[model samples]
Target: MFPFFFDPTMMLLIPALLLAMWAQMRVKSVFARYSNVGSRHGTTAASVARALLDRFGLRDVPVNRVSGNLTDHYDPRDRTLSLSDTVYGSSSIAAIGVAAHEVGHAIQDKLDYSPLRIRNAIVPVVGIGSSMAFPLFFIGILFRGQMLMDLGILLFLGVILFHVVTLPVEFDASSRALRVLADTGMLSSDEITGAGAVLRAASWTYVAATVMAFAQLIRLLFLRGMFGSRD
Candidate 1:
């Protein structure tokens, strides 16, 4: 009996793991470096977020402070934008960049961005599938049940799809943030370059996630093939 999670297939995960770690470190390093650099106009991220939302005629979306370093997000369901401790009141370039990226999501929601809508729509199912995939796969292996194993593999595919769709959503948001930051004169031309660096660094994290998801999916398929062939 081959030990699960310790097989040769785990080697497939190595590059993905390294990339994910590098992405996290790169973003943090970039965010920290730019955090020391203040905005040219000293505009707080929260205020910038509010101004952008208002400009988009999404005046009803409220910007709220949430606790944490880089936990900022836009919750479309609640029509709320939450900025983290590192961004909410900070007038730093990185903070504003992060703030604007989140507002980009809000605007995507307002405009009904198709990818964003698809991502949001499948979220509930993805949550269920992601949670059940492994357990069911393991159970199938234990009982030598092909149907159970196939079902588990299918569930994991949903997670991979989520990661794939997420890449475009994130890229589009960063793109919007940069363009708007320039158009609104929120960040100076040189400062926009700095913000772009911060946002570009942030985007790598999503790319890393997608890479990892694909690697894991491949690992699962390899394992399933091994087990199925044995059966």
Candidate 2:
């Protein structure tokens, strides 16, 4: 194995990845149990969001439908809460739970949640850093330019930080989701507990993705260092 491959930095990755994958499977299964398209709760996603926002004093936020299942998100820039077509119209526990989760983000925004704020601030930086990091690192290694290699490492580190920071944001959203749902009686105790499990599992997807990204970063770093040393 390459040096970086054996590095202890990957110690937490394996479990995190496995947990994340497991969560994905669990969430999918949970959602599958209620996949009927005809189910209706008579309450629109917009209504749920409006009510929740009003309770939290965030009535200015607009709730709208967006395409794609589970693609729902709260966009802070436009102060909009976007939900999937299924989630917006469906009144199932899953739909309400998910809608509340996205709205939890809005709550986070309103409360100036630290992790969410940091994640948002780092978004553009992480994008640029991740994009240029590996390529620059490789070029640096090929050309025996330590500066380029170091810069790449630094950039890659930013991406890693962004990933690390995302964990709390996601987890906090889930926490907020459960609390809101229970507080609002959107879900019964059993449903709240069940939905919490699903959301927890869904969080693993992010964990897994972060692990995969970190793994790739490690692999690249190992290759560069080994090859560069030889050169």
Candidate 3:
């Protein structure tokens, strides 16, 4: 039953998984190195964020610390920038770099970035679709229900669309991070390059996830087309 599920086309999906794993591993490695290496630039996360916000004239946004490694992000909902404990207090280049990336999201939100707006608009639908799509597809197969399979396909499409839109939002955030870091002198030239490597590795994880989502959608489509009941 699962043989076709693991065919040559499925093998193609391996790279995406590897890429995602590689990205996560790279983040971990960087964190390990910087966990003890204080930022050579001598700036605290709060001060760095405050300086950047001041530059952008966004002084009202609050920056706070949240628990978790590399779990930093800027919430547009309550206008808060949440940083993980390590990133919020640590002075490593990696810490500062990640913090800036989250700040980049805040900047995008402030300017109403188009990709971010689209992503936010679809979040609810994608959330529902992702949760139910695969199970529905499998149930449709078991019962040979064409309606169920089609419904699964529609929901699966939402997940894919979210992944597609996510690519740009992520890339844009990294772009913003690099520019800000360079302009503000948060990192030395070598440090900037290292941060770039880290960001690129992180971006590939999203790429991998998108590929996996697309592959699952295609697999479902094929299964439905070939074996779906006519009734």
Each model's lDDT comes to: 0.93, 0.77, 0.80
Q: Give residue 70's lDDT in candidate 2 (0 to 100).
A: 84
* TM-scores for every predicted model: 0.98, 0.84, 0.89
For lDDT, candidate 1 versus 3, the one ahead is: 1
Per-candidate alpha-carbon RMSD to the true structure: 1.0, 4.0, 2.5
29-50 in candidate 2: lDDT tens per residue?
Answer: 8766653422234566557777
- Model 1 residue runs over 4 Å out of place are none
- Give the winner by TM-score: 2 or 3: 3
- Over the stretch 1-231, how does candidate 3's per-residue lDDT look in tens digits? 456345444665676677778777877776677555566777877678767877887899988889887778887778888888887877777777777788888899999999899988999999999999978877887788888889999998999999999899989988898899898888887787767766776787788789888778777877787669445
Judge candidate 3 at residue 18 and give its lDDT.
78
Candidate 2: clashing pairs of residues: 20-204, 23-201
> In candidate 1, which residue pairs clash?
none
**Per-residue lDDT of 1-231 in model 1, one digit per residue for the tens?**
556557888899999999999999999999999999999799899999999999999999999999988999999889899999889999999999999999999999999999999999999989999999989987887788878889998998999899999999999999999999999999999999999999999999999999998898888788788787663
